[model samples]
Target: MNATDRTPADLLRSALAADPARPLVTFYDDATGERVELSVATFANWVAKTANLLQGDLAAEPGDRLALLLPAHWQSAVWLLACSSVGVVAEVQGDPAAADLVVSGPGTLEAARACRGERVALALRPLGGRFPQAPEGFADYAVEVPSQGDRFAPFAPVDPDAPALAVDGVELTSAQLVARAREDAAALGLAAGSRLLTGRTYGSWEGLSTGLFAPLAAGGSVVLCRHLGQLGEEGLAKRVESERVTNSAV
Candidate 1:
């Protein structure tokens, strides 16, 4: 971990500075036969746009709680970093009733209605396509995000000691989250430029650490796979070789 990095956003910025063209996230959905790869610059651009949406369009203030009801998809990772950039506390699969804002996938719109502040829905379509029709009372993230500014600057400086993420009933401050991520990267034997493949969900700390944060903190890249069990043995081996994966947490 960089000595100057104190938060997930800082780690991402460091990575972008080191090699913006390097692959940052390579995602696959074995269930859908979908594959997408994002370089560090591309990923940061997405994060910046999403953060602008959260901060400007949604009128999100620092310390606001955002319930993130998405799976371990690439967009989910974008939202995670966007929340950090805007100083919003991201609650993975958190209860919408108590959230100041809710970002849900197609499968979770009904539950997302409990949020009184604001609601956004993602289609999770290939190439980040828009939903054919927007869900009632919710802004379509794909439709709205495209017009947002490509650069993001938070209204106020984020406090590293403030709450940043909550998952599985555990809350972690930004600094603590980065610290844990670095520890996990070391434990996983990750290094700069290492490629880590993971088939873990984002419902637990371990899964989040391995699937996203650890690799980011270690200056490595991730091959995030969903429904990987469907790939079977031979297909999985082919993916490992094709993606040039170095470490795995499947």
Candidate 2:
């Protein structure tokens, strides 16, 4: 918990600084939506801007809650980074009982009976085309967040000892896990430009550590698959054959 250790959110600045031009995340919506990708620099700027929006503009004191309704898309990833950077209490829609805010998709409202607190809906799509207006009490998350952009000021520094994200049903402290990941990457003897293929489910602690952070720590590339099967066996076989992935952690 010393001042020296850097939290996961803190690491974002360094990651973006190191490889500002690299593509970070991509999303394909419902086959009709075009996939959008963002570079590291753009991603960082978006996060910083969002953090500023949440903190300075929103007048959100630390521990003030926000419900994030980002789906499994690039925007969700951006929101995740922004939440981490700004120190807002962000709970995505999962456990309604424990969450204070609910980020819902186009017409889907988080069930109030399941929720234990005040709820708001955040839509990821355009407004008019989307279905079902906000229920009686819930607010629109989309409209609420952008206002935060101008007012949010950056935090002084991140204490790695503080909670960065929830992992394996536990609140993971940034210092310990990141240290282990850095060390583990070194152990794997990975070099720069290594192409690392990752399984789809990276929401778990192990997945985040191995798939996202480890390869990045080693200055390697990560091949993201929504599912192991998405890349056909032949495709994966050829990739493995050509890329010469030295080792796989999964």
Candidate 3:
């Protein structure tokens, strides 16, 4: 880890500076037979656009609570980093009633209505496609995000000590999150260039650390699998080989 990295966004920036072309996230949806790979530069571009959408279009300010109701998909990862870039306090699977903004998947749009603030809905389609029709009372994320600027500059500087994430009833500041991620990476025996495969959801601290933060902090990449149980042992083995995964937490 870079000594100067104080937040998740900082870690990502370091990664971008070191190797922009290296694959950072390789996502798979076993149920749909979908696979997508994102290099550091590609991931950062997505984050920038999404951050622009959050800060510019949604008018999100630092410290505002954003309820993130999405599955363990690549887009979910993008939103996580985007929240970090803008200093938005991301609440994973949090109560919508307490959020200043809500971003939900197609499965949770009804539940997200409790948020009296801006609401965005993701169709969770393959290739990040937009919804066939925009859901009522919510902006379509795929549509709105594309028009956002490719480069993001937050209106105010993010504070490393400020609250950044709320997950599984635990709130962690950006600095604490970075420290925990580095610790978790060490505990998992992940080193630079280590490729981790995980089927874990992002609903708990353990899952979040293993699936996203740990590998990222370790200067490694992740093969995030959704509905991994559907893949039999033989298929899983083939995937591990094909993806060159060196570590696993499934």
TM-score versus the correct structure, for each prediction: 0.99, 0.67, 0.99
On residues 86-124, what C-alpha lDDT tens digit does candidate 1 reach at each position?
A: 999999999999999999999999999999989999999
Which residues of candidate 3, in runs, are more than 4 Å off? none
- Name the regions of candidate 2 deviating beyond 4 angstroms: 1-5, 26-34, 56-60, 63-72, 89-94, 104-108, 111-152, 187-191, 227-231, 235-250
lDDT string for model 2 (65-87, tens) is: 45554344445555556666665
Report the number of clashing residue pairs per model: 0, 8, 0
The TM-score that candidate 3 achieves is 0.99
Model 2: worst 10 consecutive residues (lDDT sum): 26-35
Cα error of candidate 3 at position 144, Å: 0.6
All-Cα superposition RMSD per candidate: 0.6, 5.1, 0.6
lDDT (C-alpha) at residue 192 in model 1: 96
lDDT ranking, best first: 1, 3, 2
Tens digits of per-residue lDDT for model 3, 1-250 = 6988999999999999989999999999999999999999999999999999999989999999999999999999999999999999999999999999999999999999999999999999999999999999999999999888988888999999999999998999999999999999998899999999999999998888887999999999999999999999999999999999999999
Q: What is the C-alpha RMSD, rounded to one decimal, of candidate 1?
A: 0.6
Colliding pairs, model 1: none
